[model samples]
Target: MPVLSRFALLMLFCLSLVLVGGNSNELRAESRPNVLFIAVDDLRPELGCYGASHIQSPHIDQLAASGLLFNRAYCQQAVCSPSRTSLMTGLRPDSTKVYDLDTHFRKTVPDVVTLTQQFMKHGYKSIGMGKIYHGSLNDKASWDAYPTVRGRGYQLPETLAGIRERTKGLDVKKMNWRQRSKLTRGPATEMADVPDKQYRDGAIAEQAIKSLRELKQNQQPFFLAVGFLKPHLPFVAPQKYWDLYDRRQIKLAENRFPPENAPKFALTNWGELRNYSDMPAKGDLTDEQQLQLRHGYYACVSFTDANIGKVLDELQRLELDENTIVILWGDHGWKLGEHNGWCKHTNFENDTRVPLIIRAPGMQAQGKTSEALVEFVDIYPTLCDLAGLPLPAHLEGTSFKPLLSNPQRPWKPAAFSQYPRGRVMGYSMKTDRYRYTEWQDRKSGKVVDRELYDHRQDGAENDNIAGQPDQKRVVKQLSAQLKKNWKGAVVPD
Candidate 1:
């Protein structure tokens, strides 16, 4: 053949290969699902799907019905920053060196890719607002674009008259927003008769709705995260939400005192609660106070639920639900007088466990419930699997896609949680039937105290029976497992 004829044949062959490869890549991109992530702050599993029928959380219940709900999900640590950092980076608190609220994860793992950053890297438009990380704390490099002032989860304003009444002898009413935030608040609960947009969570929902609509018109797939603040501090909500429940019918925590044999440091003395003016600094809360506070929490939760519904409704209205994967989660659980603890600072079941629900576009186990033990750290790898992206080797969690497909599959042996008190670090591992905790000395790396709560008999974690002579063998097995799982250098003096 002539030279010109041979060259034309070779060019045709190369062109065919390029066309085939391009078509294959297009198919893979179309298969990738958009993500709609919702985070609620300080929420426990006291919802309609979790069997608390009295609670008015219809929005979350509808979400639960459309997905598989993990009955036992725990955060790496119960507090805000540590738990959020662990989930966002797929690292345990010890690994991230972010056990406290003040430290950022980048300080220890500066080059680590966050969950949102990984998605953004793969041609997704990632946007976030509200309480994704701890309030006023965020990963700047993660999102394509977010709000300048990530709004506080809740911001129901007190009337000037009300503020004056609360601060009769003071000039606090004249203070600016920054100055007022530093002032001591009077009530631990607020029932303001305001609209949803009047609060920060509601405004976040509005921004998220707008993003959803705009992203649908764009070519790139999107990751939209909307974090709701509610049922958290001050327990503020719209008065309509507060009216949903009768205060007389609300139930107080079954156990109001610390567990028997609980270590001195194991039980938090309700310090977070005492910061409020109305809450007592020394003695116990009155019966009326306890029930009233519980009512406020329930109301705020309902308020948050309603806002979530708004965002979900907008997604459907935009016809994006068919290709979107929805994941609703809380940072960690909260304690409403459980084991005499008012907030999440200890390794108790009430603080460590959280509510996690995931709904994929064509999921097999829709509306099912799973009792598998899973950790917050597992979320990063799971999203990667769902997005069909390459899993990073440095991640410390297992992909839970199998659980979404098979709710009863054999899963991890246990979920882990940790918290630090002044000089001690409590390492806790939650197995199928027990929570084993060992408080180690920060400097010496020696075990200072141990606690074992058997979920079978005491699901409320009402007692610590580690010292009981009868359960010595059980304690030994759990302690051995904790040592093997936690591979971290002990922080020193």
Candidate 2:
């Protein structure tokens, strides 16, 4: 062979060896399992799997069937920012010091490592989409790539016009998004004729699918967090989702009045719903209006369920289902006219209880339900435990990884949640039999009001029997447990 030609062939062989070596390294990184973390906004435990046959949530029900569904999961706080902050930071609301929507978790705990950030530190490619961290308060360091797609909250032209008319002479540019939204709000419900992709949740699903396909090509295990916004305020969804429910068949909440003998602060004014253009500011909704709101909420849920199905289908299509840990959770539960409340603000069962499902690869608890008490704060450590990563010392939650296998095993004694109303804080503890709450004055730390509902009888929370003569012993025991708080409730390792 000619000398120049021999040299060229030798150079090409060297380049091929380097390419093969790089590919091998990528394949090694793929040994760890991928994570598909799903977050849904304002979703309660209202679904077919949860025995709410009236709701058309086939996709969520299917997820529950495949995963281990928690029958009694609760959130740290029944609001967006605080609950999400607690879940992501593995801390309670009091620890995080974030009670309202405006305050960011990082403001209090700036150096804390979030759930996604912990995954990122372990060589997993973390990506977040949609409403993951409650509106625009995102942790930039937690993700490798976090892209956002903006869309109108309402779809119809009439709704857009109504908003414009409502805020005609106001300077919207000077107002923040929340303030502007309040001033230029449309009807509480909208059923528009549009494709699924036209909405934000639908668009988020498409983005997630695309990311999954791209991640399939890359050998790194990914932590893809997709958050869907739906079943929330000003319920807006495609007309087809609305068609899934017959309005006449939808019934109003059975217990529409406040709890008997309960403190006034325990009930909410549902100011979130009242801000809508069509809602009444200070009175009970008309029967027709209540039905419409229920119908809209159900439609929004079904719409979100369909979007979730699309993402899950894509994951299965890419053959990632076998090695991926899929977790679906709601940030917090919402009230559907229970106890004369329409939003999540109080520490009531309707507002605190959320739907949680976890489908880990090769888990023994597949297609099973766990009645164990779990809290949102436990999510951070549980994921860490599943990934074989060391738990952060700052984490305040217990890992319920053992329950994934033996779900019937004994777990935490109670799930704790709290809500702040002005100067008072209502701390609630939910055990197997009852939910007990104490409204304490923040300034002096004095128990001003108390609430207790025996779930065995008053599941709807129609009556507060805290002051009853016969339940003194029960209240005293629960009060002692409440004082113990989460630290006392944590299960042994």
Candidate 3:
């Protein structure tokens, strides 16, 4: 066969090796960073990283170590649907008119591009898990492909186990006139018995890992969002996490009642129904029950932390951490007896304030905090800027890339929030030192309620200084600013 045949074969082998090496390098060079967006439902900044004494969120704290932690971040609306819709679409609730669960955003912004859609348009495989949208029905069309195993959500603990059997005898619809109610706590025996090996949070994290693994093999850019349904309601979690908190040692609010100078217009009826149903007018909940509920809330937070830890671990394991961007946010804050409110349906800080953290490779500021006034709408432009995409023309939010790059930069004078309706219509202008709100009855053109608080002076916002003669000028100034920013649209109550 001779030397000539052998030399030809050697040259062919060498060419194949060179081509393979070049292709591998090309894959590495073209690899766009992955994105992991985590959204929590009804979670306040109650974690070790956020300076909370009761909750444990080490995983999130570590993630913050690699990213930017927003100190004064807020949601557009306090409720789930409107808040989430505004954030996802990069539009205000008034602009989109998505005030309730019944309103689909497609109706408002039919041709509008969603964050997921924008990512997809830019060649990223956008995937949504759990409650990305307000409802489960519309999730499929929004995401590139919604997986049944990883994308679906679960019911709360009340429906998770034998509690379902216990609750069968009790009807949420028919149970009436109960002055107060309580949920008993015990070992989380159902954790092992749940059909899926993964808990709801665990399932989401695991699927995120799986998606990353698939991207690793295909060499494609990915945008994966994991939505954790925790610290929300019924406060159910594994018993081990419950054991972490001492119920007897829990601290109640110092100002349990309304403030001395609280204005009538500053009044809110948000949690009245929950108060009538489950909260006792006088000594309704036992000491044990109160502690147990607090324990459950914290436990759920820890459980969520563990799930976030899992996804972070996977990102590192896949060697995608350096090139990936991570964002964690909550739809809104929940009121656990704060201001006598159990849920978010008001314009107060307790109901509207949420946690928002972003971790971007090469762009992240390690252990930095930004107090810049930001809205949920701003998330739209922020993500677009991060991905090197053009901002949408219709977005009302201003991009904060400059501030993100430099945390100490000056920002807007105040963060604006609205609750638009006839009499409930109000505007909340929150600055570093004050939160001013004016409630008006639209029909009669009458000032129904006015509120002003020096946040530094009253962090909890228990006192109202709106009507004080000394503060009248300040109120008028804020009123003028409110009129300037009013979007002139009605949001359904």
Q: Number of clashes in every candidate structure? A: 0, 0, 1
Q: How should the candidates be ordered by TM-score, best one leading?
A: 2, 1, 3
Model 1 regions more than 4 Å off: 1-27, 148-184, 487-493
lDDT tens digits, residues 67-185, model 3?
88888888888877888888888888877888766688888778788887877766678777766776432545557776655422233454346334545565654543231122222
Residues 18-60 of candidate 1 have per-residue lDDT tens digits of 5434232222555689999999999998899999999999999
| Candidate of highest TM-score | 2
Candidate 3, residue 153: how far the Cα is off, in Å: 9.0
Per-candidate TM-score against the hidden true structure: 0.89, 0.92, 0.82
Better of 1 and 3 by lDDT: 1
Worst 10 residues of 3 by lDDT: 179-188
Better model by TM-score, 2 or 3?
Answer: 2
Worst 10 residues of 1 by lDDT: 19-28
Clash total of candidate 3: 1
Please write out the lDDT profile of model 2 over residues 179-207, one tens digit for every residue: 97698778899988999888888898999
Higher TM-score: candidate 1 or 3? Answer: 1
Candidate 3, clashing residue pairs? 265-449
